[model samples]
Structure formats: structure tokens, C-alpha cells
Target: INKDTFHLSQRDTENHQTNLQKFCRICGGSFKSDPYKRSYPVHGPVDDDTQALLRKKEKRATSWPDLLAKVFKVDVRGDIDTIHPTNFCHNCWNMIQRKFSNSPSEVYFPREGTMEWHPHSSSCDVCGTSFRGIKRKKRSLNPQLSKKPRMVAGSARKARPVRNVKQVSNKAVMKRIANCNKIHLSTKILAVDYPVDFVKSVSCQVCEHILADPVETTCKHLFCRACVLKCIKAMGSYCPACRYPCFPTDLVSPVKSFLNILNNLILRCPVKDCQEEVVLGKYAHHFSSHKEAEEKEGYAYINKGGRPRQHLLSLTRRAQKHRLRELKLQVKAFAEKEEEGDVKSVCLTLFLLALRARNEHRQADELEAIMQGKGSGLHPAVCLAIRVNTFLSCSQY
Candidate 1:
């Protein structure tokens, strides 16, 4: 055969071979096909049996439709009363068969036992402090291999092997610790007392407020979960502190040690007049009372300040009332001016005010209908008049 014909035949053979390679119909993992090995067809009946067993053992009715949808990545058309035949790899077939055939072995105690000395030291390697109970074993680094040069294909010079640096320098370690000081600082637990500088580093850089439910980015910079989420939503996926590219998914839960510290920290009441020092765990409950008190005081203050600057208040009220009246007149005149094609200013201002009100109340449906010129149960003229009246009344002291 000619070279071109032989190459074409070889390409076709590869394509055929790839097409013949079967995937595990159950798990969806690629099955390794061997010429010498015999393939077995493990149908979905075994899967149903295993699932039944699992449900029985767990004593809970588990829905497989959601899981099947994710696995198949298709909208299932009908109810799955029965599963179709599937081709399973040898290992998967064996595993399913063994699971069905065998029962789990129970734990049993030995009649005699012997004890040996633990290989771990009684003190921490880094801090050189004695451990309370059983000390944790120190992790030993692998022995460094000698670098050897290797000859590369089509290259005259030999390529030198890259030396892997495993040992961290003391300065680099200290710098990393300093960078993570924010997490340690916020921790109130005395179990691991950090430096004063570390303790003071718990505040968010954006709001300069004590971090709550802190999430750390890939760059090691920490921020409050809400603050960071808001920043990311408003801006783009980038760390506010270091400007390092970070996604919401990259924000990880703080370590258990940090969580313990955060929960135990003493926080002051956020209200201006309240001087209550609250535990971090109890802050949520305490803050609610503080907020209610502040709101009550605010209403009381508004009522008490009625006659303090009566003249100035009266002037401001009169100005607001005049503006409201002018707006109302303009809206009224729009019906006639609309026919003359001069309704943009009056209509737009009224629409904008309605939109502002809708946004403030988060009534998206009402806003959409209003924007479409569909009155929300009330006549547009009546709504505008009511809004203007409310605005004028609110402006009055």
C-alpha cells in the first residue's frame, strides 16, 4: 500500500478504536478497554438494587431525579420506573457484585493487646511549647534529590533539572503570619493568645469595622463576608485590599480557631446612646433592642424639636408646598400639551418620582406596570396628586 493510503487507514483505525471505547453507563466514568480482557455488561438493575439497599439502610426516601439530571445533563422526559442496561468497567462491575453479595463485617475486640511508645514529641516543634495531652507528630520533609541534566530531543544542549525548594525561610514565614494577623486579631479566645498588633488587625479595610463572618481571599487578605460580597457585586471579582483577582467562590470560611475567636470577642453596642458591651455571640439579640430604642428616641426627638426654629421650618415648608403645587399644575397641563408633543418634561418628572418611590419600596412589578403607563388600580392623575400631597406633608415640620 502507498504511504498516503496507509496513513488514511491508520487514522480510520484510531477513530474506530476511540468509538469502540465504552463509558461506564452508571457512573459515567471512561472504561479502559483491553484487547485481552473480557468485557461484562453490568445492567442498571444492579444500580436499582444498590439504591434500594442504601435507602433501606438510611431509612430515608431519597430522590434520584435531581442526581440523574445532573449526571445525564438532559431534561428527563418521563418517570424513571425502570433503568436501562449499562456497560460497567471490570472494577465497577466487581464492586457492585461484591456489595450485593457480601455483608459488612462488625467491629470486634482482641483478647490481648500491647502498647508501644508514640513516635511524636511532647512539645510543639514551631513554638517549643509543651502539649496538653498527646502531642501531634511533626511532618518531615522528603529528602532532596540531586539535580541531573537530561538530553532533549532535537536540542544540542542538555536541560538542567529544576531544584524544588521545600524549606520556608523564617522571614517569609513571619511575613505570612503578619499577613494573616487580621484573622488572629479578631479571635477573642485565650486558647491561642496572639500579639497586640494581631488583635487590632481584625477590622475590615473597606468599612474600618470589626470583621463579622470573615472570609479570606486567595491573596490572604480578610474581609467581612457581607462587605466583600457587596464590594464584589458592585465592582468586579477582585480583592479590595490587594486588588488580586478573586471570585466569590474563592472566599473560604475562616478556620475553626478563627471562628472560635470571632464568636468569643466582646463587641460594643452599635447605637450612639447605648453603651452596652455585648459578647459577639449575643450581639444579634442585643443590637435588635438597641435599634428599637434608637428608633423610638428618634421619633421622640422629632416631636420635641417642633418649635425650635419655627420660622425657618415654616419657610422650608412653604417652599416645598409651592414646588409641589407647581409640579401638580405641570402634570395637569400635560394632558393638553401631550397632543401638542410637549409632554416630555412633565410626564418624565412624574414617572421618575413614581419610579423612585417604587424602587424605595422594592415594588418591581408596580414600577414595570407604571413605566408601561398602566395605572396601578388608581388613575395616573389621582396617584400623582396623592404622591405630591404626601411629599408636601412630609416636607412640613
Candidate 2:
């Protein structure tokens, strides 16, 4: 293992399902013969590095206030009526109804010790609503056995109790099972229990205006989709309440229903001094049109391998011209020195200037090259050398 440490080795020894070690009969020392069983010393102590990294991680963890701002921008305590564990009041029930509109929903009834699944019965509750509920089976092991069922003799089949023999179809049971499986698969595929178009009745806690369908954040916080978008545009791209990291694409949902809701409730334009409303369907297009979009896109294009935006190409061209102008000025000074007959000084000055200029020009050239969508292998020296060779060759000619 020590010899193999510096060099790469692929060792595979698998077949054995169990291992038995030999014990010395005299000393009782257990032995493992395999070299892989031995432990080696690590190069250095990692406590300091680990501590520093841990500190950095803790720093990265968002504060509660920041998180709350992103998600619960409005007062959650105010909006969600507090309910006792025994039962949900009308307000909490209304909130749940507003959140999840379809398929009967209910709350936990602590008194009954069960999750109420049935919709509140309207006749029973006098609110014209039935408390939706589903009973869960309580199971336990009992030491005592109940009385055994008596078996009847096969010959006495005619003596069996004669009554109405209602024939039941097996297909009906199979259909029920199939329906259950379909529901299970659908929930699995979507990863969330989505209520259909229920967000419409939900209102912003701050504005008190009925929300135009809500968007679900990964943290499970709900918001008027447009309101959150506006918040992001106003703030530096982060989750409104928690300052959780986010991206425009993070809002996408695979399910058509959720996507449709998102499409219907997009935020207004996030630009400062601009009060234009951004329709849900047109958000992507609008964000793409921002003044900084091309610049940001250019950075992504060069460093992140995305397509360069049009404005980025223009900016790069302008920067290249500026670099070319600076290079010409230095070259002019070199010519003036050369004409004064100070050949060694002129050459040395030119060489140093070329080296320094190359570094500055490289940055500009990289911008240009990325704008042109070229690979990064080309060097500033190659371009500089070409210019020098051209000058030398022309002078000789």
C-alpha cells in the first residue's frame, strides 16, 4: 500500500463474502494479512483547514431574518390564523382550502387522533361543509389468540348456509387497485401534492389583495409569483425572505398545471425606475432585454460556455480598438527613439513596452476572442510576434 501510494494502481479483489483472521495460539494476537487492511499516515494535520472551512460554511448559512424576508415577506403569523392542536378553526381551514383547492382536504383532529381527510360536511357543520377525514388502522401485537373459526366437512357442503349468492366481478377490484397505483405514480412523478388553481383565493399578507395564484419556492414558501419576481429584481438576485440563492430557471416546473399557474402570475419588471408590468408568459423575453443582460450573458458566454450576446460583441470590439490605439502610441515612441540613433535603448524600451502592453492587451483581446466565440488556446505572444515579423520582413524587403 505504501509503494502504491505515489503511483496509481487499480487493484480489485472481491469474491469473498466473509473474512476470518488468524489468532496466535500463544499470544492471542489477531492478524489480518492483507496490506489494504493497514492504515497510513496522512501528510498534515487538517484541523485548522477543517475549522476554517467550517467557519466559512457557517457564514454561508443564511440568517433567519434574511430567509424570512425571501419567503415570508408578508406576515405569516397574521395571515395564518393560529389553531389549537385539537382542531382547526375556520380561518386555518380556509387557508388550507385556498392553498390546496381540489381533492377533499382536511387537518389533523387531535381530539379524534386522526388526520381528517373528508371535506367538512355542509349539513353536519352548519357551514354546509363536512369535515373530510380518513381513518387509519391501529395495529399491535396481542399475546392472546381469539377463537378459531370452525371448519365444515367437505361432504356437508349441501348443509352450508343457503342465502342470496350475489356474484361480484373481479374487474371492479382490479380497476380500484389500478386507480390507486396511478395516483401513487402521479404523486411520485410530480414530487408534490399540488392543489388545482387554489392560489387565486389566497391573498398577500401585506397587501391583503387576493393573490393572483401563488408560486411555490423550494423552501415551501408561497408568494404572489409576480411579487417575488419584483422583489428579486429590486434586491440583488436572491430569495426575498431568506436570501436563499436563486436563478430564473429555478422557477420552472415540469407539471403543466403548475407551469400554467406560473405563466398566469409572473412579476412586474424588476428594473429600477421602470414600473412596467411583466406578464408571466413574457418574463423570459423581458429579462433577456435588460441593459445588463448582454453584459451578463457575455460573461457567461466566455467563462460559462454560453452564447455571447449582441451588445457584448459590440463592447468587445470597442475595447479592442482602444487597446490597438494604446499599442500604436507606444510603437510611435519606439520609432522616435530609433530615429534618434539610440538603437540599444530603443530596442530595450520596445521589448519592455511590448511585454507590459501584452499583459494589458491580453485582457482586451480575450474579450474580443470570446465575443468572436473562439477557443482560449491562442496567445498574445503569437499576435505580437506576427507584428514584429511583419515589420522586420518589410524593412528587409
Candidate 3:
């Protein structure tokens, strides 16, 4: 094969050496950068041990092209045309592809070089300390391993590995803590006194198992990532410790954090009838299955000339007199839920009342433009049109 195959070029070797040196410089000697640059793909006579050693060394090497080959399959140093720039390398790529195989490109790689983390800590929650436990990557990849085929549902599946917590040097961690010393810890809950007595140790409040990893809200309230997400799911973005309003995006790298927490917590599906306890990382898929099943059951609450979810219509009527004042209050309460987008359904109730109150609001054209921008596709526009048509029909009813 060596006689027929192209040998490693001088330039390729030089670039490989340079990348190795760069890695050595960045990681010090704690890791070997270019452990096997000389071990080219053999055509002839290397011993099995030597070949195995070479492969192992190649795995540890971090050169972009080399790592690219190991991670993905095509040699990045070779014909770049053979692989797209977006090809996955093996490290975590298989899991990523299987999990998020259906996600929109926008969600997967929003921008180049953009990565985020969720913590898996071992120390004081508020202080965000990493006391002694080893930081291990907990991935969410089981759904990929299943051989059974499943139908796709609303939106593409956005399965991703849970976020990893940032591993700053102990010095950097202390520095960050010091920078926020002036930010007072809430006196409302003493360190010794916790909301749940069993939670006295640094365990997550949600499952009440697994040592908790600290996550912060914009309000600086500290809770286990899992517990806080559950609180957010149930209670919205207000700080549980204090009533301070916080945004979902401000929930300490939320998507990554939630994914990490979910990945780590493999739980049985809570829906009645199906009791599969998928790992948290696979929850997106489980929920997708749940959602598809729910859709097959058809719209539950449709009335004459009215869409399903008519109880929401009553809420809309109530919101009209008070301008959805009740929902405004309750909205904050349910703000953290995955169903919050459905809360937009609540807008139907409010809009209906508004239609009764005045004609001075958005004309159809203005509303269409707004919907187009937010919807991102023909389906959204069609949906908005259907909802508008429904409300107009309801007025007659």
C-alpha cells in the first residue's frame, strides 16, 4: 500500500511538528502534543506493537488536521474536498450526530469557535468551588446506540451532550470569587439551613441524589443545576431564594447546564403508560416521542369554530377585561417551563379580548410581518394566519 499510496509530504510533517510544539507550549508537558508525528500510515513493515502505539499516540495528538483525521475519517491534510468542513471527528462526534442528527444548523454551530459549559462541581455551591472530585465528561449518547427506528416529530431533535462545567485553575476560581466578594450572599438562607433538610449535603434538590454541581442565576442565587432547572420549570425565572427576576438565558449557561444535568440524571419517563427511564441526555428524544404521541391523540379541546385548547380561550376572555392581567401574574410563575412557548397560546385569549375592546391595534399586515420574522418559515406564517382566522371565526360564534 505504501508503494501505491502517497507518502507524508515534507510540508505536512513540518506543519504537524509545529502544531505539536504549539500544543506542548499550551499544555506544558502534562500532555504530549505530537506523540507520533513520525509514525506515518505504514505501507510495509511495522510490528503490531509499534503500529498500535502509533495509533494511540495519534489519538492524543491535537494537531487540527491530525485530530481532524482521528476525530473524523478523512485526512484533513489530504484532499480537503474529500470531506466537508463540517465533518465530525470521532471523539464526541458520533454521539453529537446521533443526538442532534435532526437539529437545525443554527442550533448546532451557531458561530465558529463558540462553545459553552455547564458545571459538575464538587464544592461550595455559592462559592462555585471544585473541591476534590475528578471532573469527568458525562455524555448523553444512548439514543444513538438504539437500533430501533423512531418517527421524527415537531422540530428536529436537538439532542446534544450536556454542557461541561468550566475547569478554571484553582487560582482563577479564587480570583473570580474574590471579584464578587462585594456581592453579598443572601442572608435569607443560612449555609447550615437549607429549604430541604435532606439537601443539607451538596446534593441536587430535584432527584435528591448525586453530588450537586453549583449553578448561578443572574440574581446570584446558587442551587444545583438540576434543582434550579426544575425550579425554573415549575417557578419561572424568579430567584427561588429571592424574588428577583432573572431571564432564562441568564440561568448560568442554561442550555448547556440543563443538558449536562439531564445527561447525568437517567430517569424513567413520567408519562402514564410508558415508563422508559431514558438518561437525561436522551430526554429531548423521549419528550419528542411524548409530543408525537400527544399530537396523534388530536386536539383535545376544540369547540364549534374554535381550536383545541379552548380553556385557553376562557383565559383569553378573562385576560381581555383585565388585559390578561391574571396571565401576566401567572406567566412569571410558569415562565421557566418548556411549555412556556405554548404560553403564547395564552396570547390568543388576550388578543381576543383586545379585538373586542378596540380596533386601534395591529392591522393584519403589520402582524404578518412580525410573525414572519419570528416564525422563520412558511409554517409559522400559516399558523399565525390560521390563528387569526380562528379568532375572527370565534368573534362570530
Candidate 4:
């Protein structure tokens, strides 16, 4: 029994020595023992380069496990807890120290029921100036400085009492009278829920008369239809009010509601002795009737005249006929001149004569038809004259 126990003890000792020989003491790496090699102690203070190499190896070994764990989305703390406690490698420790070298080492943790300490600066950070108390100056004790002077109730200067004396001018009085007359005249017509001077306000800006068939331009200016057309013909394509570019085609008809309102307005007859107040829509008819009545009265007056008056009337008619014949002859001459290629002078002459005899619609119609038949050969001036004549005839109607 003693021999067998000794053999078992030797076997146990050899196994322990072999296991110890397989591992390095410094880096904890495994190695095989070789008969040709000599072994030395590796755990000791190394040279700077050797120490750096070991630190780098340790860092790489430690960091890879952490990085791999993070990449695989594994809980680092749980993994470490399952294996071993977390300890910084040499390089990591040095790196952390370098990163936070300027940071405070100790952080304050207030105890329960204890007030936290706060730090404050004694000087201004910007100018580095320390604060100091300043002494204020004392006021004088003289009576003038201490008390305000008082004046007697009656001694204060009184403001001059202003009296506005208005002087009445004769012209102003006359204007007021004219306004009153206009109001009186307007009152005779339909009663409108507008100011007494509203008629004047709604009058055409171009003609300074009550608007007839009012049209509004794109520029927002309002004008009578005929008045605006006349202006467009005279002036170029532009607004009269602000000179904004606007063409005749740009003039829009007033809204139907607006036209209805205007048509409802009552106006007095324009005839000298006629006192008829007619709605604007029927004014044309009323005026035509008045003209017909005036012509009949004129004819009756001539028929009721004595022999001498009849003779005088006959002579006047004969002279008017002679004048008409002369105008016809002049027109024919101008037309001949135009056909002979004297366009400018002939066109001017024709336009002037047509304008002078614009009231003769029959003659105007004949002239317009003749010029239009000439087509492209007609002078522009002559065409303008025909257009003006047409406008005048339409206006008369």
C-alpha cells in the first residue's frame, strides 16, 4: 500500500507542472515547451516600445469583443456579467485619461436635506472690473431748491380769447344760390336716396354733364359712352385720368344692375321752355317729341304770317337752297380732286365740308356709301370723316 501511494503522488505532481508550463505568465497565451529552447520570466517592467506594443495588443483584444457585441446588438453588460467583470485595457485607460485631463476629478453629490452650493464671480467677466459702492451727491438745503415758487391766482397770464370772424364773398353766396337752384330743380324729378349734389357727382368727367349710357374703362374711370368714344377718337389709346394705356376696346359696359340704376334716374327736359321731368331711359323719346313740336310750331308761325313775312321766308329758303347747291358742288369738286390723286388736300377739304354739314344726314349717307364703294383706294382721312358723320347721325337719332 505505501508503494502504490508514492507512484500516484508523482503522477499528480507531473500533471500540475505540465499544465503550468503550457501557459505564459505575462500575456496569458498558451505555448509548447521545446527541448532546444530556454525559458525566461516575461512578467516585468518593459522598455517603452515593448510596453506600447503590449498595450496595443491588449486594446485590440479588448475592443474587438465590445465592438462585435455592439455590432451583433448583444447587451454588453449582460454578456460581461455572464463571463467576467468589465476592466479597461491599458491603452483604453491611457486614452480616457488624456481625453478628460482638464475635467474635474470629483463631482458634487448633495446629501438629503442639505442646500447645494453655488459659485459666483466677484468681477465682471468682460472687463475684469470689480464692483464697488458709489456715493450719491446731497441736495442743497436752499429755499429755491427745496420749494417751488407759487403765483397769485390772478397773476397768471391769460390766453388771448380767439374770435373767428368769417367774411362772406359774393362769389360764394352766388355758388350757394346756384347749388340751391340745382337742388330745387332736381327735387322736381324722382326723389333719390342720395345727396342733393349727387347728380353732379355722377356726371361724365369728359362732358361735365349727367352721364348717358355710362361705361367704365379698365383703368376704373367712368365716362359717358359717346363722350368716351369722342375722347378715344381725339386722343390716342390712353386713360384721360392717369394717362394709363387703355384702348377703346378695353372700355367695358357697366354692370346690368348699374345700368338699371342709371336708367331709373329722372332728368329734366333739356329744351329751353320745356319743363318736363322724364326718366333717363325715355329722355331720347321725350327730346324727339319736343323737337317735332318745335318744328310744327315753327311751320304754323310761318303759315300764320302776313304777305311781307311770307316773302321774307321765301327769300330765306331760296338762299338756303343756293347755299346747299354750292356745298354739293364743292363736295363734287373735292371728290374729283381725290380721284385725280390729290388725296391729302382733297381729303382735308371733304372732311371740313362734311363736318360743317354734319346735320345733313342724307348727304352724309350718300358720301359715306360713295367712299366705302371706293374700298382700298379711299384715303384714311376721308374714311375718318365718314366715321365721324356716321357717329353724328347716330347721335342725332
Candidate 5:
């Protein structure tokens, strides 16, 4: 190899070797951030601290290296743990000792190869800790390997800042010493655009919304699966509507009667352009067709990063212009609609009040043009209509 290639290969090999040295032999986990990283050398004189610790627990061993070989199933014969860190970490050492010490073994693993004490104190090449004796510290996990606890079931409201623990909004964290036992974490049916139905048979009693993924309770009460699941998780196995035992085990199915009823019910498409009635059971299948059509025309896409996502956003100014055109087209369509019964009955006081309020001489040039004058080419009547509509629009809100 050339001189440059040789050096580069050497550097990569060194890095690979270093990474192997960081992992614990027992659990195959890192010790880079572990302060209590410890190991009982495969080649051992059996340190005094280690012997005493074992004796206190009424445990005896012929050889540490032999014990490790049997437990780990590795051919450990070296004085160094550079390639594979086949040395027990602090936590793993204590665990393995307690587990294996229950019943002492005599002839399981015959001590393999005689061991001799090094002249000087044998120290770890990784953390610079001595391998001669046990120097135990408060056991802690490597922060790099440690993970934050999973979020519990609830709206994750940001807690307001307070001076003391007493001033905190919720005492749930303070009261509990362990992780929450509630595993059924799902979104409430009330939060989503659920089916609208007046029939009580097809509705969830708990959420008061039309049933979504309906599940039956022991008390013959029906509810949204998410609603009951969350209720059982938070409030225990009693029915919310009635104090009947509603545990998951107590829940039973009434055949497919609920689904049969649901399949017969009609639902309107949520998409604004095509609000046609469809069978509730087939709504999702019908919606997928609209979705496919929209995708082909570049009208709908995944919001996440990709080519399809950027289709509308590629030319920002052009996208805005298209949006403006659509809005204007909608307004034109609304104007063409026949104004029959109750057309004048709708609220217009907000419009009149806003129009009069903006008709002052001190208004900006843009506002002046909107009202009337030579700046705008619109008729007086048209200007009044425009002013009324603009002021009454939700943009003001």
C-alpha cells in the first residue's frame, strides 16, 4: 500500500479498537460515561476486597477466570481488555454474584490455566482504574446509554413556573414513587372529527360522541374503545357511566351487531368539494379514492419532507398567487348564488360599524382606495360592497 493509504487504514483500525474497549463484557453496553466501570480480570490473583465481599455473603469460588468463562462462554486468556471489554461492569458484577451465589458449585468449571500476580498494580487501560482490588462507587448508568421515561397518558400541558414543590399544579409526580401502571394510552374520540349520528345505539355513552371503534362493556354499556381503554387505565376497572365492573377481562363482544348498525348508517365526506353521503363502514375506502385523485393532480401530499411535499412550496410567490385566485373564485361563486329567503336576516351590523369606522380622512392611502376616490377604478356602490365584505371578513378577527 502507499504511505497515505497505510496511515489512513491504521487510523481507522485504531478507532475501531477504541470503540470495542468502551463496551462492558457482561451486558455488551458502553462505559464511556460510567464512573463505576469495574472488572474482575480473567487472569486474577483474587483481590482481598473481592475475597472478603464473597466471604461476607458465604460464597466461595476456585477461580474468577473460570467462573467468567462458564458464564460468558468466551475464551478469556489475556491480561488486557482492549479488543472486547470482557470485564464485568460495576452493576453487572454485583448482579451476577448474587444470582450465581444461591447454590455453590464444586466441579462445574475446572480452573483453567495457572494465574500469577503482576509485579506492579494492574490498572485498566480504558478508565485507568486498578484491577487488583474492588474499588466500588455509587452505581450509576452511562448518560449516553440512559433514556428519558416515556410520556404518560394525558394532555401534556406545560406546568407554570412556581417557587416551591407545594406551588406545583399537579401532585401526581410527587405522590407516585414508580412508573405509571396504566399502559392503555390512546387519543379520545372527542378530539377527532368523529361520525355524527343521533341514534343512541351507534354512539359512545362515555364520550357522548358517535361511537368510534366501538367496544362493549360488562354493564351492557357501549363506548369508544379509546374512551374505555383510557378510562380503565386512569380510573380503574369500573364503568364511567355506571359503577359496573368494566375491566378489559370483563369486556365482551355482542357479535357484530354494533358494526352491522354502523355499516347501515350514512356519513358525509369531510372533503369540502365532494360532500356526498356514503356508508359509514366504507367511508375510509371512498375517502382513499379522493386522496389518490388529489395526489395525482399535486393537490394533496404528505406534509413531511420529500419531493411531493415541496411541490406546492417550490415557488412561494406563485403558490400565494394561486391561493389568492382560489379565494377570489370562491367569492365570485358566492355572489352568483340566488339570495332567496333569510338572505338579509344574517348579521351585518359588524360590517356597517367597521365600514363607517374606516371611512375617516386620517386613514392610510390603501384604506382610502378601499373606501372610494380616484385611486380605485371601482364604482361607489362597488367600493361600499368591497369595504363591507373586507371589514366583515375573519381576517379582522
Candidate 6:
């Protein structure tokens, strides 16, 4: 046995019957070693994309394994626990979903998890590479153990991801995890279990909870960051409390003194068996020590990634600000082409970007909104060009 790290390697060497579970049968990509790439069995109905496509294409619905066997001549019927079952990584699954043929547009590579896959070619028909251990002079351990994948496609049966208790049990981490879903965050959060009568003025109208990451509107109404966004979407771009027309850029942070009140609120840890009470302003400082949680959460920023959700929220806001800058530049450049309706084109394009590319069609929508006195605000770069005014962003635009 090697000294520094004892014989878990020995156990893995001696075990057998599960060596192939580490790879995707279609691509031969290694997901088990990296833990980030999404993997799924070829045996069952996986996602809505698969189901909808199956319903539209075939009169009789079939499991993925059945479909793969029929179309690709690849068989994956054996269960992994007993035999070497075929599986597919997310990229390979997408290729099959988009087209059902002998040749796919792209062929996933054996080292795909570490490197990019190649575009389809005639030689790719063989898909000729796979990495396997030689079994060697000493009987190598091939331990049979199920690993909880980061993302699996189906809900009917899914493995729960394991969390390190030691990581979650650390004092600083326990404090952060305790407040992960509980404290001030960008998205509309669950109502606090504790009373909020003292901070009633800042409570979100939709959630009836103390405002966490509050947003101030052009109409002077206040709401939790996601609460206002969701409300406006539901109300067809109208403000939550008032019917005043609003756009995403119209939501700014509250004034410094007003915000300082919310930031100063002391939160008692609501998670069970924890006694840490921390100031909202200082809560973020403790987050750096929680690297273990970061490893499990991976590179995602969504709330389901769990602890340090606030930090992720901050990152998301920064990315949006960057997007806003790009959008401003794109609008300014595109608007100059339609110089006759330059101001209106910039306004309408920012809102109806997903609509038709024709400027005339968008100009009509902008004219209607203008007639109704619902013109959206302009980005700072073009603020002088258009006759629109903006409130100073407390968080700094």
C-alpha cells in the first residue's frame, strides 16, 4: 500500500464488473473522472425535448435504448450493476435528438470531457477509439460504486448528489448555508420565518416578506429584485404597485441611506442547531472560507447550487450590467442605419429584440407605445440623443 493516500486505489483495482460505467458508450467520453459533464442512460425516456420529438416523429413512442438500437445499431440494454451498459453524454444525446440517421452532424470524441469533439466525417462512422485499463500483472481493483451526477436528464429516477458533511459542518460554512436561501438575494426569495414588522416599509408587495436585494423603479415603487421583474412580466411591462409602464433598465437600486437600513438588519440564524447571528452588511466576508461548497456547486450560478447564493447573485448582476453595455453599443450602431427613426428604433429594438429584424415593424410598435406615453428609458450613452431622462442608479449603472 502507498503511504500518503492509503488503499482506496487498491479497493478500486480489485473490483470488477463496473469498469465501463465510467464512460458514455456513444462517445466514450469520461464523465466519472470530471464530475461536471451531464450523463444519462440510453434506457429510458429522459427529457421533454426527447418526448416531444418522439411524439411528433413516430406513431409509437419508444425508449431511447430501443431507438438507438434500431437507428444506430448500438445496444445499451444491460443494467450497469450487472453488465457493461451503454450510456450517452449530453452532447451525444443532442445529436441523436436533432437527427435520426446513420451519420450525425457531430461525433463526440473519447477525450470529449477534457477536449472538444469533432465534426462528423466518413471515418467517424467507426467511432474507433475507447480508453480502457489493461487489467495488468496485479489484479487491478475496478470498484463498483454509483456516483450522483451533477445533472441527470430524468426525474422518474435520479440519484441525490452527495455533500461532504465536514464541509457543511464548518462554522463559517454552516453560517452561510444557513442564510443561503434565507437572506437578501437577487431573485424573489421565500418569506422569512422570523418576524419582519420592524422592516415592514421594505417588504415586497408580492411575497409579503422583507425586501431582499430590493429594486427601486422609475415609478418610485420598491420590490425585491426578481419580484418586480416577474410582476412586470405578468402585467405586460407595468410596474408592480402602480400601472406605470416599465422596462428592465428602469429598475435601479434604492438610495444609499434607505439601503443602509436593510443592510444593517441583523439576522438570527434560522437553520437548526446553529446560533450565529450576523449583520447583513458583513455576511459576505465569511463566504471565502466555503470553497468546499463551491466545488460541489460547480460553475453554476442558480439558486439550486445552494450555499453562497448571494455571491452568485452578485456575479449575475455584474454579467447583466456587461450585457446592458453591449446592448447599448449594439443599439447605437444599429440605430444610425435607420437615421430617420434613430431614437425610436433604439427604444423599440431594446424591448422587442426577439421580434422581427425589420426596423419598420419595430418602429410601428415604438410609435404606438410613444402615443400611449409609455416610451422606455435610454442607456446613458444615448441618453442625450433621445429626450428620455433617468434616475441616478444607487448601485452605479
Mark the regions of model 4 whose C-alpha exceeds 4 Å error after superposition: 1-197, 301-397
Which one wins on lDDT? 6
lDDT of each: 0.50, 0.38, 0.41, 0.48, 0.52, 0.53
Write model 6 residue lDDT over 147-201, tens digit each, in one string: 5334456652443333444433433332332243444442222233435554556
Model 2 misplaced regions, further than 4 Å? 1-103, 109-258, 291-397
**Cα deviation of 158 in candidate 1 (Å)?**
24
What's the ranking of the predictions by TM-score, best on top?
4, 5, 1, 6, 2, 3
Which sequence of candidate numbers ranks them by lDDT, best first?
6, 5, 1, 4, 3, 2
Candidate 4 or 3, higher lDDT: 4
| lDDT for 302 (candidate 6) | 62
Per-residue lDDT tens digits of candidate 3, residues 14-75?
A: 43333332211111121222343222221123335434544654534433444333322334
| Tens digits of per-residue lDDT for model 1, 1-397 | 6999889866654443333334333433344343445344432223466567656656332333333332233232342212221243454444333323323322121112111111122231211221122256775545573454454664633332222222234224323323444332334332345576666566565544567778877656777777777777765565666444457887887678877776777765545767676777777788678678868987773544545634434577667676468666766677566646456645655666676765543343345346658656665666566556556877621
lDDT of 4 by residue, 78-148 (tens): 32211222222232222233322323232221112111211222232211211121234564566756575
- lDDT by residue for model 5 over 1-397, one digit each (tens)? 6999889866655554555455555555456446766556546555675577667767666566665554444446654543555344554455345334432221111122222222121242433432222346766767885686555545343343344444342233311311222422122212234444445566655544456677776456777677677666776555655543346775656558657866666766667878787776776689789979878889643467655534445668877678568765655565457433332322233344465567642233234464344464556675566656666874442
TM-score of each: 0.26, 0.19, 0.18, 0.28, 0.27, 0.25
Per-structure clash totals for the candidates: 2, 27, 13, 0, 0, 8
Would you give me the overall lDDT of model 3? 0.41
Q: Which pairs clash inside model 4?
A: none
Clashing pairs for model 5 are none
- The positional error of residue 347 in candidate 4, measured at the CA in angstroms, is 47
Position 25, candidate 3: lDDT: 17
